[model samples]
Target: MRLEAVGRRYGARGPWVLRGVDLDVPGGQVLRVEGANGSGKSTVLRILAGIDRPTTGRVSGRPRTAYVPERFPPALPFDAHGYLVHLGRVHGLGGRTAARRAERWLECFGIAGYARTPLAQLSKGTCQKVAVAQALVAEPELLVLDEAWTGLDEDARAVLDDAVRARSAAGGTVVFVDHDPRRLAADTTAAHRVQDARLVPVPPDAAGGPRVVIEATGGGVPPAGLAYEPAAPGTLQVTVPAAESDAVLRRLLAAAPPWHIRSVRPAQPPTEPA
Candidate 1:
């Protein structure tokens, strides 16, 4: 699936959430979209999910996409599980199939007890789980999630993480927003960040490449790091050039001193001939 030069606008006064956005996400791949709070991240996801059409652009793919929005019909007059069941049916699943799938996801997310609980009575995290399970229940070829980790406990989070990996492994594509660099350090995953109203590459750590872990921000996403994992404890690294060492040091201090900062070192020089 891909979006080419997509753009959207709410009204004359409304700014274009997404413009000239180009994305190419193949099946069996995880494409993470990350940014500040209102950089049109959600807007872009919705467009990909086929919920909203781009104001000016083109998208091509026939795979059934499942979108788990940030908000749903919670605190309403409906049983949480009941709503999920109904949603499954809407997605072309029948009684036996829907029930079985819902049960599995609920159990996986540790929310099976809320199967019959009222939607209004469930916690924020529980609601989030239900929303995610709904998207997965359809067994979609494309999964579109908006802040999928919004409200989930560690256990539940693990379940969803495993599910995502499993789905992608099974030839599914995923486009979701996340603020955790640690969670997306896998080699197979490719990430992009929305900044200056555009997308930029977020290269995951690959072998010896030095990367910094920073929770800095410019616009949309929250305080999240965009650096590679440190190879060793007390080692702070970054992908930027050595010329920016001072800036990187400042940001590191802002993120909090490393467990042990023997000293700040510039880029390592290559060894000469033996």
Candidate 2:
């Protein structure tokens, strides 16, 4: 997906939130869009998602996409999972099929217990999880997420991290808007920070992968950008050519069970270890 000189401003008298921004996001990889709140990160994502039209410029890669906004769309009086089932059906799932998928994701996020809970009674975190599940239920070719971490607890966050990673691995394109540097810079091939109404690349090393993993408290999903396969009983391994292990480990160390780097062995050792 690519944006060419995209710009947008709300209201007749408002200033431009995004100005002359250009970005190219390749498929099967992640693009991290970073900025402070109100810095146009979400605006860019919305434009990409077709939720909002950009005031100026062209955005390619509409349709064939799924977008999860910062706050959820008003589902009014339905139960949380019911709303999700509705969204899933809207995105192409049907009847019992939609309900099944919605139930699966709610369970994955540890919200299965709330499947029958009304949206109004759900916590913000739970609501946000449902909102995220709505976009993710269909597994669209292009995934756009905005401030996706809001209101999420540790477990939900891990579930999200894994889904994003899996999407990228399956060759789906991802555009993510995030204020947290960890989320922005995690396992993505390209990282851009929005400032002064423009998107700029962070230094390559600074935007690199996880550098440390001290411990993993709970088991969930891993971060994006690396392929890890079973190495030994109770162990998994990953190696990235032309990328530093320490850099990747650092990002992995900061997250929950899976992102937690249990140990850092030498990247390359005597032939016997392999």
Candidate 3:
């Protein structure tokens, strides 16, 4: 899908929130949208999700999409499970399939106990989980998340992270906005920031690149949003952008029973084919 010269505003004479925006949403990738508060990030996402139409340009080839807005209204009349099931059917699932998926996601997010509780009775964080679950129940071809991680507990946040990766891995497009720069930094295929009422592409290195490799030991768990795997007995290897290497090192050293650094170096670039 593509947004061609898209622009948006409120009233006839209201100042533009976004103008001259162009974006491509391709399958099997993750796109991160960034900007200061109220800088039109949400507007861009809304347009891509087909929740709001562009005022000036056009969106072409829109796919089956699901969106999780920045604010989730918990005043809905149904319980968490029912809301998710309704959304699944709306997204073209059979009744039995919708109910099954709803149960699965609620369990995955550690909210199975609250499946029958009314939405308005759930806490803010639980409500946010319900919002996210609704978007995921149908396995949308395009997923747009606007600060969908906010108010989620650590475990639920990790669950959502896994879900995003799963969607992208399954050849779906995932676009999201979050306050934390580190959220899914490793998985993002591209990034853009809203500035001066327009969308600006961020260079790969500037956003997060020129990767760094860290060899370490003794840290029980590596930091969140980093790519890592076992290297040797009692040791692990982590890779992240050079820009975030320092922060990663600090986190390792600050952990209880701090991790012992084996080596820190820039990851070797791929060799050209002969």
- Models 1 onward score TM values of 0.73, 0.75, 0.81
C-alpha displacement of 116 in model 1, angstroms?
1.0
Ranked candidates, highest TM-score first = 3, 2, 1
Model 2, CA-based lDDT: 0.74
- Model 1 lDDT, full chain set: 0.71
Error of 2 at 186 (Å): 4.4
List residue ranges in candidate 1 displaced over 4 A: 205-274
| Number of clashing residue pairs, candidate 1 | 10
- Please provide, for model 2 over 1-274, each residue's C-alpha lDDT reduced to its tens digit, 9 standing for 90 to 100: 7889988888877898888988887788788887777677777788888888878898886547888888875458889788888878888878898888888898898988998888888888888998898878888788999888788998788788778877887889888876666563446778788798888887656644433323333334555565466555545566543235554565456545545356654354326754
lDDT of 3: 0.89
Q: In candidate 1, how many Å is residue 91 off?
A: 1.5
Per-residue alpha-carbon lDDT of candidate 1 for residues 130-179, written as tens digits (9 for 90 to 100) = 88998888888988878787678888776776667667767898888876
Q: Give the runs in model 3 whose Cα sits over 4 Å from its true position.
A: 207-211, 214-239, 242-274
Number of clashing residue pairs, candidate 3: 0
Could you tell which candidate, 1 or 3, scores higher by TM-score?
3
Query: Could you give the candidate ranking by lDDT, starting with the highest?
Result: 3, 2, 1
In model 2, what is the error at residue 260, expressed in angstroms? 15
